[model samples]
Target: MSRGFLPRQHGAWAMLLIPFLFGMFAAKPVWQHALLFLGWLLAYLFVYAFLQWVRTGQIRLYGRPLLLYGALLMPTGAALLWLEPGLWPLVPLFIPLFLVNCYYARRNRERSLLNDLAAVVQFSLIVFAAYELGGGSDWRLAAALFAFSVLYFTGSVFYVKTMIREKHNVKYYWVSVGYHLALLALAAICYPPGLLLPLAVLLVRAIWSPRAKLTVKQSGMLEIAYSLLITCSVLLVYAV
Candidate 1:
């Protein structure tokens, strides 16, 4: 019996995070900005921890570009915490992460950082879209929204894989689409906290796949289904 969606660690992380979100969302308006900064700093901490112990022989996620990835991501996220005016602050950090995740994937040509990194980027875009829907137009807050979305979505993927040694052979489109719509809905309902549901699905999938190869027809089906579903979901949200 193969695992379907989540790793054991994801469940544990979810347990810890649920409390944090509850508190953050419950804050006063002034605290929301501070909480956003805290989230950015937490991301920096993730990189720091990844760097400090990634080479412990038991694990080795930081190498070459990822090392540089850690270097820039810390300051980039910090600057955004201070300024919160534009996406420039995050560009340096995210571009490097995205490029390197791609580089590693290309170099290794396996289920490497590329997939999860892409997931994060895509998720960030979805969060960005939420701004337009929610009638937000601030460039700075828009960027932060995108950044946190990326961090949460991609962060979930990496954490799940590292902690649980999640393995899978899959494509990512509708899953993320479902995630985007779900997040949008939650945002509409004034429950940005609900975004975790779709993300959790990805984390779970990371840990519990059979790693089976799909036939050409099956692969085509998945791709088409993903495209159609995501398009419809996004359109429906916009229409509403």
Candidate 2:
């Protein structure tokens, strides 16, 4: 059962995820933001506790990595509150990936999906907060960030469906990721200063994920899409 399990679980998780992302993305340098940061930390702790409760209802976890996360996160929260939005976006990221590993070990696929969804949410929040801190509202940059979110979310959905719709070929995973990378890279190549966001996207993808292989057809489609995006980008550049 591939994504047959996903539909069963996505709705409940989405309700929680939406608010978390909302809070994260809405981050700015307000004096009142400290209180909100405390709230976010509380939320993060609650989620971790919930995941643990689900994993082991008995509640006895003295894991080294968990201790490590707390050590890292305490300092990180300090940095973010001190106006280090650049690094803060990534802190929430560490927790989810650890959760993802737990999910994989348990063979609970829905948990992994939630992890990816959570990742995009955090990364988008980073982009939003980072840009705002850099200057006043740049709606154009926000739009581009949204576009990147759309592409990533859509790619993630399609990749899951492709796994379900086509059978359990995990290679399609890389295909969708590669599709996303190609699009971002082309965007960077076509537009100057476009590289930053794309590079961020690429870095997140490259660093956080384990390597996976794709099939010929998957590779071919990505290549075609990359070529097409490049061609259209060039045409638009010339037209402008």
Candidate 3:
């Protein structure tokens, strides 16, 4: 019933969906990838519930029951190992990130820039996982997805910090703007065509959104629109 029982962060859901979709679209999906997607979804749900439990110290809402349900769902994910035993090696990769998430949740610093960057890295792993699941063998392509995800989400961290947490903090505000501009330049130089729309949209948000006196709900709506634009732009670039 509580929002914590579901994915509360729309931005995070966008991050999760875009890379997974990008990888799937980039490669050929197999039957096992369905299991992989399911497992990944359940894993995130469990992590969200667990983090909420840790942060609020309330077991009744997001505690044992949700934890138990999430743990039970993981076996289905583990079953993916049977489909492609190669997935076994990648299992342990997420453990350290889980530990880090737990640490941040405990300290109530889950939104800190460092934590956001760590999450960007962690969630970006989905691109690699999806690549492997969808029968993609090109490490280079997977790496590219990871890089774009990092750039986009890092910008997201700065955007949120500037707009909500530190709006009046002029130093961080400019830093966010500068980072967005640098990223735009880098994208233009490296992968100009594919990244054009997404980076341009990000630059606009980095410059304008933080200064707007939008309420929380309005800002959330705007973020959803931006997320969709970025997601669609990436999909379109690859589709072409």
Model 2, range 104-205, lDDT digits (tens) per residue?
435544335565565445434534443444343655645555455445454544454443443344576566667667766766664455344534544344
Full-model lDDT for every candidate: 0.41, 0.46, 0.81
Better of 1 and 3 by TM-score: 3
**Candidate 3 — what's its lDDT?**
0.81
TM-scores for all candidates?
0.31, 0.38, 0.91
Q: Give candidate 3's TM-score.
A: 0.91
The TM-score measured for candidate 1 stands at 0.31
Number of the candidate with higher lDDT, 1 or 2: 2
CA deviation > 4 Å runs, candidate 2:
1-62, 84-119, 160-240
Model 3 Cα lDDT, one tens digit per residue, 1-240: 555577667778877777788787777777777787788777788888888888889888777658665776868866777777867777787788778888999999888777788788788888878888878888887787778878888888899888888999999999999999999898888663867877888898888888888888999998898888877887777634
In candidate 1, position 165 carries an lDDT of 42
Give the residue spans of candidate 1 off by over 4 A: 1-90, 102-110, 113-115, 122-214
Give the per-residue lDDT digits (tens) of candidate 1, residues 1-240: 212112222222332332233222222224334445354435534443343333232234334334454565666556644654443443464556545544444454334657455535633542332343234546565554444444444544543343334423233433433444554455546424434444344334333332334454553454344333433333333223
Clash count for each candidate, listed in order shown: 5, 0, 0
Show where candidate 3 strays beyond 4 Å.
none
